[model samples]
Structures are given as C-alpha cells and as structure tokens.
Target: MITLFGVGCLVFLVVCALVVARTRDLLAATVVFAAYSLVMALVWQQLQSPDVAITEAALGAGITSLLFLLAIGRTRRTEDEEG
Candidate 1:
C-alpha cells in the first residue's frame, strides 16, 4: 500500500517538475530544480538506500545546483530573442 506521505511527495515532485519546465527565469527554475533534487534525495533515503541518498544530496542538490547557479550568473537570466 502506498503511504500518504509517499503520495504527497510524488505530487510535490510532479508539481516541481512542471514549475521548472514552465518558468522562463533560469534562476527561478534552478531554485525549483534544486528543491526537486532535495526531495528526490529524501525519497531515496526513505527507500532504504542511504548511500544513494547521500550521493544524490551531495551531487544532485549541492554540486549540480552550485554549477547551475554559477552558469546562470555568467549568462542571461531569461532567453530572449536578440536581433
């Protein structure tokens, strides 16, 4: 049986995915993506995979987010047509 908490986490994950896809702002999208990664880490933890959870938290949420933020800082925040 699926637990209520699991369902809630799944729902939140989907919502975060949609928000990340729809948002044009790179910074906002990156923030949401980080949140999604953190939740994914939590899910991995609940699945009895502490190794995967720690790796995901460190790499997915931490290193990846930092790289994205650094890239965004050096580029345009939004994609706009340039003539």
Candidate 2:
C-alpha cells in the first residue's frame, strides 16, 4: 500500500542522491547530502520509527554534515596555500 506521498519522498531522495553524486562542488554536494539525510529522516518518521528519525536528524543531518563542512574548509585552505 504505497501512497503517493511515500513515492514522492522516494523520488526526491533519489534525485538528491544523484545530485550529490554528480555535483563537483564540495559545498553544494554537502548541502544536498544534508537534504538527503533530512528526507531519509522524514521517511523513517513516516514509517513509525521516531527514534531512528531523531537519530538520523541529529547525526546524519546535523553532526555529519558539520564535520564534512569543516573538513572541506580545511581542504580548501590547504589547497589555497599550496596554490
């Protein structure tokens, strides 16, 4: 019994994943990845798993994304220094 809302979310998830994979810009990709995490959290919530959703929102969307941004900043600094 897959509803339209579920299908829409799945489509959006796939689209975001594709964008993240295809984009060359690290910052843009990171933002898209965060969006993908949020979509995943929403899917988990819809599936009746509040715990998983909250964990995904906190870790996946929040902490992991922040780490990635920080790493990207470091890499960019190193590249700028080298160049």
User: Which candidate achieves the best TM-score against the true structure?
Assistant: 1
User: How much is 2 displaced in model 2, in angstroms?
Assistant: 2.0
Give the Cα lDDT of each candidate. Answer: 0.89, 0.89
Q: Write the per-residue lDDT of candidate 1 for residues 1-83, one digit (tens) a residue.
A: 56788788889999999999888888999999999999998888777899999999999999999999999999989966552
Q: Write the per-residue lDDT of candidate 2 for residues 28-52, one digit (tens) a residue.
A: 8899999999999999988999999
**What are the RMSD figures for all models against the true structure?**
2.1, 3.9
- Using all chains and alpha carbons, the TM-scores for the candidates as numbered come to 0.90, 0.87
Best by lDDT: 1
Candidate 1 lowest-lDDT run of ten: 74-83
What is the model-wide C-alpha lDDT for candidate 1? 0.89
